[model samples]
Target: MMINNARHSYVCPNCHSALEFQTKQVVCQNCKNTFPIDEYIPDFLLTNQEDGGEKLKNRASRFDDLSKVYESSNWGGSPRIVVWLLTRKIRYKAGIGLDVACGTGVVARSMAKKINYVYGVDISMGMVQKAFDLSQKNTINNISFARCDSENLPFGDNFFDFVSCSGALHAFPNAEKALKEMQRVLKTGGVLTIMALLQKNIHSVIDPTKRELKKSSTDEEIIEFNKAHSSMENLDVKLHRFTLAELKMITKKIGFNNFKYLKLGSVLIFSVER
Candidate 1:
């Protein structure tokens, strides 16, 4: 496989300032923080669990987004299979690709051979740990799972050649901002494929009463949950719920070329090039 991971000069993970490399380690001359590079890739903020959401332990995922296709038994790998099914026709092999909100590298493990240097970034520790375990089991050395947020990725601009975000946009506080960042990391001719739930009256897809009841957990229970605030308000006000016209406007705004949109299940598959 072609080595696509950049060994470019790095910056402070904390402040994002230029860093000085010393003895296989990069240290922030300003922040005085240090990061080690094991097997060539710098472990910049790799161990930070702050990016990890609540560790779900062994309990089943109650609100799993991929429940329709994947059962409680399959875990993250199942969702990865779904992504492959959606975009198998497009060329992804040996291309640098990112699986955002890549919970436990489920979709990523399946995509490792299809892409070079698959970078799986997610905020959930439980997911990251699960992904890490799978990567080790599969011995997929080129795949790197980082504890990172979609809103604030550690990568530089124009880095990856391809990106895939499956069933992730709905969880974002600002989907448009996240989309722009995904676009920013891609090279001029790079490709992006995102799968997200259509906001067109979600009740039409999910039962209205069931969805509403899930939102009203007890106050004591709220403290236990990681995502306490609901993004429905933000979705209601600022979200561009995917009409064909709106989807076209978004891809245009994101600087994508030859954009195309397709519906898969209740999710919209936005495929475009940079």
Candidate 2:
């Protein structure tokens, strides 16, 4: 299937109006809000700095720092199986898809090669930029990147055939809101897949290390950490643990049915039809 490279699939976050594509930006004709295109990626974050600005900035900065090492890393094992599963779930190969919080576009790139065209959205400008750069370097044209909030996607309702959020749900500020946005953009009968890090994995791998560290820590070291950072409040990626039951409750409440899930090592995969 041929895609129109000139035409964009986006809407204004402020007014839900169609955006006109220009050379360096996409403008909303109705609201007259201009979203600048930096480094060839259209940015859709319209909220002011006061409204969750620091949180957004901190998330962006954290992922930006991760982008430096993202390409070299294996991205937590093979994503080929994930892409294969998604491609099989998709009814056809002609429709467009969305990848939310697509850090470095690993899964998006694989999906672009296997199935349909893809649009990858990330909160971090650095991650989006790296995704674009990698796409360009590899000559992959079917996938595009945008800087946007996952909790509030800037797209029309029922616009996507499939949506995939992999290994990033636990880090979202509001996981339920993000899931709702995913449901809102999905077409009826469309598939939504979320891959998250399970709490069991953390207990197995991380808890023992923490216990050892705590056993060895001096009183001064503990006091200094408490004085400087206080609680673990400012941690960039706070892993919000979830169980299978909790996931089922959220998915069912959001109007999704035909639920299916699987555990792939530390990653918990959930696939539901909207």
Candidate 3:
């Protein structure tokens, strides 16, 4: 697989500066921070303070470990359903697309068929590597993968014609920031589609015992129970289950309009025009 020079599509994820593409690395023109290119995929993952701290790193590590079996795993919901909902409204045939938190590139690859080009980004290197590998093995030339945070995208503002995030919004540490970043990069009137878990019940899915405790315990007891079960917490980052109403409210507040959604079981697939 040859490297497609998509350098013009990226900016410094840290400082939003221009980048100088080299043979094996990309250098930020303003911050002077450098990122490496491995096997034709650029690595734009920030570290320490710039990387959303330790919790985000842990989440990325978790996905990294899951990358090997992610395609065959049930963790990511039905890809065919997700792709259908996401591309239902897309009519453009020659525009740029972005897939955020693109685990294993299912949505990204599907999106590539509708758009002229697509860029798939994920925080986990393992996931990005797998995405790139699959694209290469299948001879997909118009799509590329990068390791970058969703909250701080490595692209310029209003650069994408369509943006889609499927089944991974709830796992983001700050969902609002991620949404805002998606909006920022999207061109005016661009489409944004997202699929996430709907918060239906007050009982915790992470810890089902909380439901039993909530029935008879006081507020203090709930707090105590949380502390005791803290070690059992998976993903470390708080998993936010968003209700449809909440999703509408937040996305509207962030400047997205024409909201529409379809509910399939507990998963909510929604689309909005920018």
Candidate 4:
């Protein structure tokens, strides 16, 4: 199936210049920085040695290692619940959509049927490639994937009609900056939905034990834990689990309005308008 690459607009990460899409690469007319299109997915991340720092690099590497089996694993919770939360409030059926930190294109593929077009972006190349491959296998042509940083998106301001980030916000190096970028790319009055793990009272009691076990457990023990727990709290990574008040404060400070959220088993599914 031929992928439709013309549905969304892209800008250069360096000079923020409009990008010219080619068969094999994407060219920046102003900066002359050409980004290669590998396996039909464009690479929009800039090549700076100190771009994301070590923490970001490690997180990307972890996702890359998990990309192949990401969808098969039970890490993202139930598909029905995710789809319902992502699509229930979508007001426009033919509008453009975006999925940030789209690990394996779960949100992108799910939104494709509802929205006219969807763009999925992630920092890990392996995750992006897996998303593109899955979309091709499913013959879903209305969606596109790219490798990019959520904190610094490659699209122009006020471009998307709907945006979403699922189950990955807590893992970002700078969640606030990423949220600001999401707001910047969303058109005025566009809806922004996010699903993230929040810090709860129960987590205060369980997180410490989990962290200690994760630090001292064997590979087999870790595998057992992974099989038993499907939440982000079980992951062996540095995460900043936001409280309800903290999330509200951050979104309010970012100028998002009509903030509404639903709490489902420690996962917070929230929506705000730009």
Best by lDDT: 3
lDDT for model 4, on a 0 to 1 scale?
Answer: 0.78
Residue 50 alpha-carbon offset, candidate 4, angstroms? 3.8
Q: What does candidate 3 score on TM? A: 0.84
Report the number of the highest-TM-score candidate. Answer: 3
Q: How does each model score on lDDT?
A: 0.59, 0.75, 0.81, 0.78
By lDDT, highest first, what's the ranking?
Answer: 3, 4, 2, 1
Compared with the true structure, what per-residue lDDT tens digits does model 4 show for residues 1-274?
Answer: 2344552377886677888888889999998988888877788776654664455555566667556446652233226687679767777898999999988888888889888888899988888988888888999988888888898788888989999998778877679999999999999999999988887543553456567766676776556545433333434556878898899999999999999999987889999999
Tens-place lDDT per residue, model 1, 210-267, is 3543577555443333231222222323334556566677778877878776766656
CA shift at 264, candidate 3, in angstroms? 0.6
lDDT, candidate 1, at 208: 51
- TM-score to true structure, per model: 0.64, 0.82, 0.84, 0.82
Candidate numbers, best TM-score first, in rank order: 3, 4, 2, 1
Candidate 2 to native Cα RMSD, angstroms: 6.2
Runs of candidate 4 with Cα error greater than 4 angstroms are: 1-4, 49-58, 73-78, 200-237
- For TM-score, candidate 1 versus 2, the one ahead is 2
Candidate 4 local Cα displacement, residue 268, angstroms: 0.4
Better of 2 and 3 by lDDT: 3
